[model samples]
Target: MALTGETSTQLALRDPDIRLMLRVRDDDAEAFAELVELYHHRLVTVMHHLVGNAEEAEDLAQEVFLRVYRGRKKYHPKAKFSTWLYTIANNLALNILRTRQRKPTIPLNVRDSGPLGPRPAEQLVLDRHAQPEDRIQQQELAAVVKQALETLNERQRIAVVLNKFEDMNYAEIAEVMGLTTKAVKSLLSRARDNLRVVLQDYIHMNEPGQERKDEG
Candidate 1:
Protein backbone atom coordinates (compact mmCIF):
# COMPACT_ATOMS: atom_id res chain seq x y z
CA MET A 1 0.00 0.00 0.00
CA ALA A 2 1.16 3.53 -0.67
CA LEU A 3 1.70 6.03 2.08
CA THR A 4 -0.69 8.96 2.29
CA GLY A 5 0.75 12.10 0.74
CA GLU A 6 0.80 13.85 4.12
CA THR A 7 2.63 10.92 5.71
CA SER A 8 5.14 10.92 2.85
CA THR A 9 5.65 14.62 3.41
CA GLN A 10 6.31 13.96 7.08
CA LEU A 11 8.86 11.26 6.21
CA ALA A 12 10.53 13.47 3.64
CA LEU A 13 11.01 16.09 6.32
CA ARG A 14 12.66 13.50 8.58
CA ASP A 15 14.86 11.64 6.07
CA PRO A 16 17.21 13.52 3.78
CA ASP A 17 17.19 10.60 1.35
CA ILE A 18 13.44 10.86 1.03
CA ARG A 19 13.83 14.57 0.33
CA LEU A 20 16.31 13.78 -2.43
CA MET A 21 13.96 11.15 -3.83
CA LEU A 22 11.21 13.72 -3.79
CA ARG A 23 13.47 15.95 -5.83
CA VAL A 24 13.97 13.09 -8.21
CA ARG A 25 10.24 12.76 -8.42
CA ASP A 26 10.18 16.45 -9.37
CA ASP A 27 12.72 15.70 -12.15
CA ASP A 28 15.66 17.31 -10.47
CA ALA A 29 18.61 15.95 -12.43
CA GLU A 30 21.23 16.79 -9.82
CA ALA A 31 19.22 15.15 -7.07
CA PHE A 32 19.02 11.93 -9.08
CA ALA A 33 22.77 12.05 -9.73
CA GLU A 34 23.51 12.57 -6.08
CA LEU A 35 21.23 9.72 -5.12
CA VAL A 36 23.01 7.43 -7.61
CA GLU A 37 26.42 8.44 -6.32
CA LEU A 38 25.43 7.66 -2.75
CA TYR A 39 23.85 4.27 -3.42
CA HIS A 40 25.91 2.89 -6.33
CA HIS A 41 28.57 1.02 -4.41
CA ARG A 42 26.20 -0.25 -1.72
CA LEU A 43 23.73 -1.60 -4.26
CA VAL A 44 26.54 -3.21 -6.24
CA THR A 45 27.97 -4.93 -3.19
CA VAL A 46 24.56 -6.30 -2.30
CA MET A 47 23.83 -7.46 -5.84
CA HIS A 48 27.24 -9.14 -6.09
CA HIS A 49 26.62 -11.14 -2.95
CA LEU A 50 23.12 -12.10 -4.05
CA VAL A 51 23.96 -13.18 -7.63
CA GLY A 52 27.53 -14.40 -6.94
CA ASN A 53 28.99 -12.62 -9.97
CA ALA A 54 30.56 -9.17 -10.14
CA GLU A 55 29.51 -8.48 -13.72
CA GLU A 56 25.92 -9.52 -13.19
CA ALA A 57 25.86 -7.52 -9.99
CA GLU A 58 26.92 -4.37 -11.78
CA ASP A 59 24.25 -4.87 -14.43
CA LEU A 60 21.62 -5.49 -11.76
CA ALA A 61 22.65 -2.38 -9.83
CA GLN A 62 22.30 -0.34 -12.98
CA GLU A 63 18.92 -1.86 -13.55
CA VAL A 64 17.87 -0.89 -10.05
CA PHE A 65 18.76 2.73 -10.69
CA LEU A 66 16.95 2.59 -13.97
CA ARG A 67 13.91 1.30 -12.14
CA VAL A 68 14.05 4.12 -9.66
CA TYR A 69 14.29 6.62 -12.48
CA ARG A 70 11.40 5.08 -14.33
CA GLY A 71 9.22 4.95 -11.26
CA ARG A 72 10.07 8.43 -10.05
CA LYS A 73 6.67 9.89 -10.84
CA LYS A 74 4.98 7.25 -8.70
CA TYR A 75 7.44 7.55 -5.79
CA HIS A 76 5.93 7.57 -2.34
CA PRO A 77 7.73 7.59 0.97
CA LYS A 78 5.90 4.53 2.21
CA ALA A 79 8.98 3.58 4.21
CA LYS A 80 12.57 4.71 4.57
CA PHE A 81 14.09 5.40 1.15
CA SER A 82 16.75 2.75 1.70
CA THR A 83 14.09 0.19 2.50
CA TRP A 84 12.23 0.98 -0.70
CA LEU A 85 15.49 0.75 -2.65
CA TYR A 86 16.41 -2.62 -1.22
CA THR A 87 12.91 -3.91 -1.78
CA ILE A 88 13.49 -3.33 -5.48
CA ALA A 89 16.92 -4.93 -5.25
CA ASN A 90 15.55 -7.98 -3.47
CA ASN A 91 12.88 -8.51 -6.07
CA LEU A 92 15.30 -8.20 -9.00
CA ALA A 93 17.87 -10.51 -7.42
CA LEU A 94 15.28 -13.14 -6.55
CA ASN A 95 13.99 -13.09 -10.10
CA ILE A 96 17.48 -13.77 -11.45
CA LEU A 97 18.10 -16.48 -8.85
CA ARG A 98 14.81 -18.18 -9.70
CA THR A 99 15.72 -18.15 -13.35
CA ARG A 100 19.04 -19.78 -12.51
CA GLN A 101 17.25 -22.47 -10.59
CA ARG A 102 15.19 -23.33 -13.65
CA LYS A 103 18.26 -23.58 -15.90
CA PRO A 104 21.34 -24.27 -13.82
CA THR A 105 24.75 -23.56 -15.28
CA ILE A 106 28.22 -23.00 -13.96
CA PRO A 107 28.55 -19.33 -12.99
CA LEU A 108 31.58 -18.07 -14.88
CA ASN A 109 32.70 -15.45 -12.38
CA VAL A 110 31.56 -16.70 -9.02
CA ARG A 111 32.96 -14.63 -6.13
CA ASP A 112 34.93 -16.36 -3.40
CA SER A 113 33.93 -14.17 -0.47
CA GLY A 114 30.30 -14.23 0.55
CA PRO A 115 28.56 -11.18 1.96
CA LEU A 116 30.48 -10.13 5.09
CA GLY A 117 28.44 -9.97 8.28
CA PRO A 118 28.92 -9.81 12.06
CA ARG A 119 29.34 -13.50 12.60
CA PRO A 120 32.02 -14.83 14.99
CA ALA A 121 34.60 -14.72 12.20
CA GLU A 122 33.61 -11.16 11.36
CA GLN A 123 33.99 -10.27 15.05
CA LEU A 124 37.64 -11.30 14.73
CA VAL A 125 38.02 -8.47 12.23
CA LEU A 126 36.69 -5.78 14.59
CA ASP A 127 40.12 -5.20 16.09
CA ARG A 128 41.48 -2.62 13.67
CA HIS A 129 44.91 -2.76 15.26
CA ALA A 130 46.04 -6.29 14.55
CA GLN A 131 49.30 -8.02 13.67
CA PRO A 132 49.93 -9.24 10.13
CA GLU A 133 49.17 -12.82 11.16
CA ASP A 134 45.90 -11.72 12.74
CA ARG A 135 44.88 -10.00 9.53
CA ILE A 136 45.69 -13.16 7.57
CA GLN A 137 43.60 -15.23 9.96
CA GLN A 138 40.78 -12.72 9.61
CA GLN A 139 40.90 -12.97 5.84
CA GLU A 140 40.86 -16.77 5.96
CA LEU A 141 38.01 -16.73 8.45
CA ALA A 142 36.02 -14.32 6.25
CA ALA A 143 36.43 -16.64 3.30
CA VAL A 144 35.22 -19.53 5.41
CA VAL A 145 32.24 -17.50 6.58
CA LYS A 146 31.43 -16.62 2.99
CA GLN A 147 31.50 -20.27 2.06
CA ALA A 148 29.25 -21.02 4.97
CA LEU A 149 26.86 -18.31 3.79
CA GLU A 150 26.54 -20.08 0.46
CA THR A 151 25.05 -23.07 2.24
CA LEU A 152 21.90 -21.15 3.08
CA ASN A 153 18.81 -20.94 0.86
CA GLU A 154 18.22 -17.71 -1.13
CA ARG A 155 15.74 -16.12 1.31
CA GLN A 156 18.07 -16.87 4.20
CA ARG A 157 20.97 -15.35 2.33
CA ILE A 158 18.97 -12.19 1.58
CA ALA A 159 17.96 -11.82 5.22
CA VAL A 160 21.53 -12.25 6.42
CA VAL A 161 22.97 -9.88 3.82
CA LEU A 162 20.53 -7.09 4.65
CA ASN A 163 20.80 -7.58 8.42
CA LYS A 164 24.55 -7.96 8.56
CA PHE A 165 25.87 -5.70 5.83
CA GLU A 166 23.17 -3.06 5.59
CA ASP A 167 22.84 -2.83 9.41
CA MET A 168 19.09 -3.10 9.06
CA ASN A 169 17.00 -4.33 11.93
CA TYR A 170 14.52 -7.20 11.60
CA ALA A 171 11.69 -4.81 10.73
CA GLU A 172 13.71 -3.25 7.94
CA ILE A 173 14.73 -6.63 6.63
CA ALA A 174 11.15 -7.81 6.79
CA GLU A 175 10.05 -4.78 4.79
CA VAL A 176 12.73 -5.30 2.19
CA MET A 177 11.98 -9.01 1.79
CA GLY A 178 8.20 -8.51 2.00
CA LEU A 179 7.92 -10.91 4.97
CA THR A 180 6.47 -10.55 8.43
CA THR A 181 8.89 -9.68 11.24
CA LYS A 182 8.29 -13.11 12.79
CA ALA A 183 9.10 -14.76 9.46
CA VAL A 184 12.24 -12.65 9.13
CA LYS A 185 13.37 -13.71 12.61
CA SER A 186 12.80 -17.35 11.77
CA LEU A 187 14.70 -17.01 8.51
CA LEU A 188 17.68 -15.43 10.24
CA SER A 189 17.63 -18.06 12.99
CA ARG A 190 17.72 -20.87 10.46
CA ALA A 191 20.46 -19.15 8.47
CA ARG A 192 22.57 -18.73 11.60
CA ASP A 193 22.09 -22.35 12.56
CA ASN A 194 23.14 -23.47 9.10
CA LEU A 195 26.22 -21.26 9.22
CA ARG A 196 27.11 -22.60 12.66
CA VAL A 197 26.95 -26.15 11.38
CA VAL A 198 29.02 -25.32 8.31
CA LEU A 199 31.61 -23.33 10.26
CA GLN A 200 31.82 -25.60 13.31
CA ASP A 201 35.03 -27.19 12.04
CA TYR A 202 36.70 -23.84 11.45
CA ILE A 203 35.36 -22.38 14.68
CA HIS A 204 36.73 -25.30 16.67
CA MET A 205 40.05 -25.14 14.87
CA ASN A 206 40.38 -21.43 15.53
CA GLU A 207 38.28 -20.42 18.48
CA PRO A 208 37.40 -16.74 18.53
CA GLY A 209 39.41 -14.71 21.04
CA GLN A 210 36.15 -13.44 22.51
CA GLU A 211 32.70 -14.81 22.07
CA ARG A 212 30.21 -12.60 20.23
CA LYS A 213 26.66 -12.64 21.60
CA ASP A 214 25.07 -10.03 19.39
CA GLU A 215 22.01 -10.84 17.26
CA GLY A 216 19.37 -8.96 15.29
Candidate 2:
Protein backbone atom coordinates (compact mmCIF):
# COMPACT_ATOMS: atom_id res chain seq x y z
CA MET A 1 0.00 0.00 0.00
CA ALA A 2 1.32 3.44 -0.89
CA LEU A 3 1.30 6.19 1.71
CA THR A 4 -0.47 9.24 0.42
CA GLY A 5 1.45 12.52 0.20
CA GLU A 6 -0.36 14.00 3.18
CA THR A 7 0.29 10.91 5.27
CA SER A 8 3.93 10.90 4.23
CA THR A 9 4.25 14.53 5.18
CA GLN A 10 2.56 13.93 8.51
CA LEU A 11 4.87 11.05 9.20
CA ALA A 12 7.88 13.18 8.32
CA LEU A 13 6.68 15.67 10.91
CA ARG A 14 7.95 13.30 13.57
CA ASP A 15 11.55 14.38 12.94
CA PRO A 16 13.58 15.64 15.91
CA ASP A 17 13.20 19.33 15.24
CA ILE A 18 9.46 19.03 14.88
CA ARG A 19 9.47 17.57 18.36
CA LEU A 20 11.63 20.52 19.40
CA MET A 21 9.04 22.87 17.96
CA LEU A 22 6.38 20.99 19.86
CA ARG A 23 8.40 21.64 23.00
CA VAL A 24 8.65 25.28 22.01
CA ARG A 25 4.87 25.32 21.92
CA ASP A 26 5.04 24.18 25.55
CA ASP A 27 7.26 27.06 26.74
CA ASP A 28 10.55 25.26 26.32
CA ALA A 29 12.92 28.14 25.69
CA GLU A 30 15.95 25.86 25.36
CA ALA A 31 14.22 23.89 22.65
CA PHE A 32 13.64 27.10 20.78
CA ALA A 33 17.31 28.03 20.85
CA GLU A 34 18.18 24.55 19.74
CA LEU A 35 15.91 25.00 16.79
CA VAL A 36 17.61 28.30 15.98
CA GLU A 37 21.02 26.70 16.20
CA LEU A 38 19.84 23.92 13.92
CA TYR A 39 18.55 26.12 11.18
CA HIS A 40 20.22 29.53 11.38
CA HIS A 41 22.96 28.91 8.79
CA ARG A 42 20.67 27.09 6.42
CA LEU A 43 18.04 29.80 6.71
CA VAL A 44 20.60 32.52 6.13
CA THR A 45 22.04 30.65 3.15
CA VAL A 46 18.68 30.25 1.48
CA MET A 47 17.56 33.79 2.26
CA HIS A 48 20.84 35.25 1.01
CA HIS A 49 20.51 33.42 -2.25
CA LEU A 50 16.87 34.42 -2.53
CA VAL A 51 17.40 38.14 -1.96
CA GLY A 52 20.95 38.76 -3.28
CA ASN A 53 21.96 40.48 -0.05
CA ALA A 54 23.81 38.68 2.72
CA GLU A 55 23.36 41.30 5.44
CA GLU A 56 19.66 41.65 4.79
CA ALA A 57 19.32 37.89 4.68
CA GLU A 58 20.95 37.59 8.11
CA ASP A 59 18.63 40.23 9.55
CA LEU A 60 15.63 38.52 7.98
CA ALA A 61 16.75 35.13 9.33
CA GLN A 62 16.74 36.52 12.85
CA GLU A 63 13.30 37.99 12.31
CA VAL A 64 12.06 34.64 11.06
CA PHE A 65 13.15 32.93 14.30
CA LEU A 66 11.76 35.76 16.40
CA ARG A 67 8.44 35.53 14.61
CA VAL A 68 8.43 31.79 15.05
CA TYR A 69 9.05 32.14 18.76
CA ARG A 70 6.28 34.68 19.18
CA GLY A 71 3.93 32.37 17.35
CA ARG A 72 5.06 29.31 19.29
CA LYS A 73 1.86 28.85 21.20
CA LYS A 74 -0.04 28.49 17.98
CA TYR A 75 2.47 26.13 16.43
CA HIS A 76 1.30 22.82 15.10
CA PRO A 77 3.31 19.94 13.69
CA LYS A 78 1.48 19.67 10.41
CA ALA A 79 4.70 19.67 8.40
CA LYS A 80 8.45 19.34 8.68
CA PHE A 81 10.07 21.82 11.05
CA SER A 82 12.40 22.98 8.29
CA THR A 83 9.40 23.59 6.07
CA TRP A 84 7.71 25.70 8.73
CA LEU A 85 10.92 27.59 9.44
CA TYR A 86 11.37 28.27 5.72
CA THR A 87 7.78 29.46 5.47
CA ILE A 88 8.69 32.21 7.91
CA ALA A 89 11.85 32.80 5.87
CA ASN A 90 9.95 32.79 2.58
CA ASN A 91 7.48 35.38 3.84
CA LEU A 92 10.24 37.64 5.11
CA ALA A 93 12.18 37.34 1.86
CA LEU A 94 9.05 38.22 -0.14
CA ASN A 95 8.33 41.24 2.00
CA ILE A 96 11.89 42.52 1.67
CA LEU A 97 11.76 42.03 -2.08
CA ARG A 98 8.50 43.97 -2.24
CA THR A 99 10.02 46.80 -0.24
CA ARG A 100 13.07 46.82 -2.50
CA GLN A 101 10.81 46.99 -5.54
CA ARG A 102 9.32 50.22 -4.17
CA LYS A 103 12.63 51.86 -3.22
CA PRO A 104 15.94 50.96 -4.78
CA THR A 105 18.78 50.33 -2.34
CA ILE A 106 22.33 49.13 -2.69
CA PRO A 107 22.80 45.47 -1.87
CA LEU A 108 25.30 44.67 0.89
CA ASN A 109 26.65 41.47 -0.64
CA VAL A 110 26.78 41.16 -4.39
CA ARG A 111 29.86 38.98 -4.64
CA ASP A 112 29.24 35.36 -5.50
CA SER A 113 26.26 35.38 -3.17
CA GLY A 114 23.47 35.11 -5.64
CA PRO A 115 21.24 32.26 -6.78
CA LEU A 116 22.64 28.75 -6.38
CA GLY A 117 20.56 27.18 -9.07
CA PRO A 118 20.35 24.55 -11.77
CA ARG A 119 21.77 27.48 -13.67
CA PRO A 120 24.78 28.72 -11.69
CA ALA A 121 27.90 30.82 -12.13
CA GLU A 122 30.03 27.72 -12.26
CA GLN A 123 28.09 26.39 -15.21
CA LEU A 124 28.70 29.68 -16.95
CA VAL A 125 32.39 29.27 -16.24
CA LEU A 126 32.30 25.83 -17.78
CA ASP A 127 30.69 27.17 -20.89
CA ARG A 128 33.57 29.63 -21.17
CA HIS A 129 36.18 26.86 -21.35
CA ALA A 130 36.47 27.03 -25.10
CA GLN A 131 37.02 30.79 -25.03
CA PRO A 132 40.05 31.34 -22.85
CA GLU A 133 39.98 35.05 -23.63
CA ASP A 134 36.33 35.25 -22.60
CA ARG A 135 36.68 34.03 -19.04
CA ILE A 136 35.02 36.51 -16.67
CA GLN A 137 36.09 37.38 -13.18
CA GLN A 138 34.28 35.16 -10.70
CA GLN A 139 32.52 38.09 -9.08
CA GLU A 140 31.54 39.47 -12.47
CA LEU A 141 30.21 36.09 -13.50
CA ALA A 142 28.15 35.74 -10.34
CA ALA A 143 26.71 39.21 -10.77
CA VAL A 144 25.75 38.46 -14.35
CA VAL A 145 24.05 35.20 -13.41
CA LYS A 146 22.32 36.95 -10.55
CA GLN A 147 21.05 39.58 -12.91
CA ALA A 148 19.57 36.88 -15.07
CA LEU A 149 17.85 35.43 -12.01
CA GLU A 150 16.38 38.84 -11.23
CA THR A 151 14.60 38.64 -14.57
CA LEU A 152 12.30 36.01 -13.02
CA ASN A 153 9.11 37.03 -11.27
CA GLU A 154 9.05 36.68 -7.48
CA ARG A 155 7.30 33.32 -7.47
CA GLN A 156 9.66 31.75 -10.00
CA ARG A 157 12.72 33.13 -8.25
CA ILE A 158 11.65 31.71 -4.92
CA ALA A 159 10.87 28.38 -6.51
CA VAL A 160 14.30 28.25 -8.15
CA VAL A 161 16.10 29.18 -4.95
CA LEU A 162 14.36 26.51 -2.90
CA ASN A 163 14.72 23.87 -5.54
CA LYS A 164 18.39 24.57 -6.21
CA PHE A 165 19.86 25.74 -2.91
CA GLU A 166 17.76 23.79 -0.45
CA ASP A 167 17.65 20.63 -2.57
CA MET A 168 13.91 20.63 -2.10
CA ASN A 169 11.78 18.69 -4.52
CA TYR A 170 8.57 19.85 -6.15
CA ALA A 171 6.49 18.63 -3.22
CA GLU A 172 8.48 20.57 -0.67
CA ILE A 173 8.63 23.64 -2.87
CA ALA A 174 4.84 23.41 -3.26
CA GLU A 175 4.44 23.10 0.51
CA VAL A 176 6.53 26.18 1.24
CA MET A 177 5.03 28.29 -1.52
CA GLY A 178 1.41 27.30 -0.79
CA LEU A 179 0.98 26.04 -4.32
CA THR A 180 0.08 22.78 -5.96
CA THR A 181 2.95 20.59 -7.19
CA LYS A 182 1.68 21.16 -10.69
CA ALA A 183 2.04 24.89 -10.19
CA VAL A 184 5.62 24.44 -9.01
CA LYS A 185 6.33 22.55 -12.21
CA SER A 186 4.98 25.38 -14.31
CA LEU A 187 6.92 27.96 -12.34
CA LEU A 188 10.23 26.12 -12.84
CA SER A 189 9.51 25.62 -16.49
CA ARG A 190 8.84 29.30 -17.01
CA ALA A 191 11.75 30.38 -14.84
CA ARG A 192 14.19 28.33 -16.90
CA ASP A 193 12.81 29.85 -20.06
CA ASN A 194 13.20 33.37 -18.71
CA LEU A 195 16.73 32.61 -17.53
CA ARG A 196 17.71 31.25 -20.91
CA VAL A 197 16.42 34.38 -22.59
CA VAL A 198 18.08 36.80 -20.20
CA LEU A 199 21.32 34.87 -20.27
CA GLN A 200 21.44 34.00 -23.92
CA ASP A 201 24.28 36.35 -24.74
CA TYR A 202 26.38 35.38 -21.74
CA ILE A 203 25.70 31.68 -22.25
CA HIS A 204 28.26 31.73 -25.02
CA MET A 205 30.79 33.51 -22.75
CA ASN A 206 30.86 36.51 -25.06
CA GLU A 207 30.00 38.98 -22.28
CA PRO A 208 33.64 39.29 -21.31
CA GLY A 209 34.42 40.65 -24.75
CA GLN A 210 32.99 44.00 -23.69
CA GLU A 211 35.17 44.27 -20.59
CA ARG A 212 38.25 43.15 -22.49
CA LYS A 213 37.49 45.57 -25.28
CA ASP A 214 37.02 48.34 -22.74
CA GLU A 215 40.47 47.60 -21.28
CA GLY A 216 41.95 47.56 -24.80
lDDT digits (tens) for residues 1-216 of candidate 2: 112456533654647787788889889999999988988998898888778888988888999999999999887667777888888788878888888878756543455344543334345545545563455565676677886787677889999999998999999888888889999999999999878866665655545544544454
| TM-score, every prediction | 0.76, 0.75
Structural RMSD, model 1:
8.3
Pairs of residues clashing in candidate 1: none
- Tens digits of lDDT, candidate 1, 51-133: 77899999999999989999999987888899889989999988888888677665433342334444334443343335434
Highest-TM-score candidate: 1
> What is the Cα-based lDDT of residue 76 in candidate 1?
77
Decoy 1 TM-score against native:
0.76
Best by lDDT: 1
Give the Cα error of residue 18 in candidate 2, in Å.
0.7
The Cα local distance difference test for each model comes to 0.79, 0.77
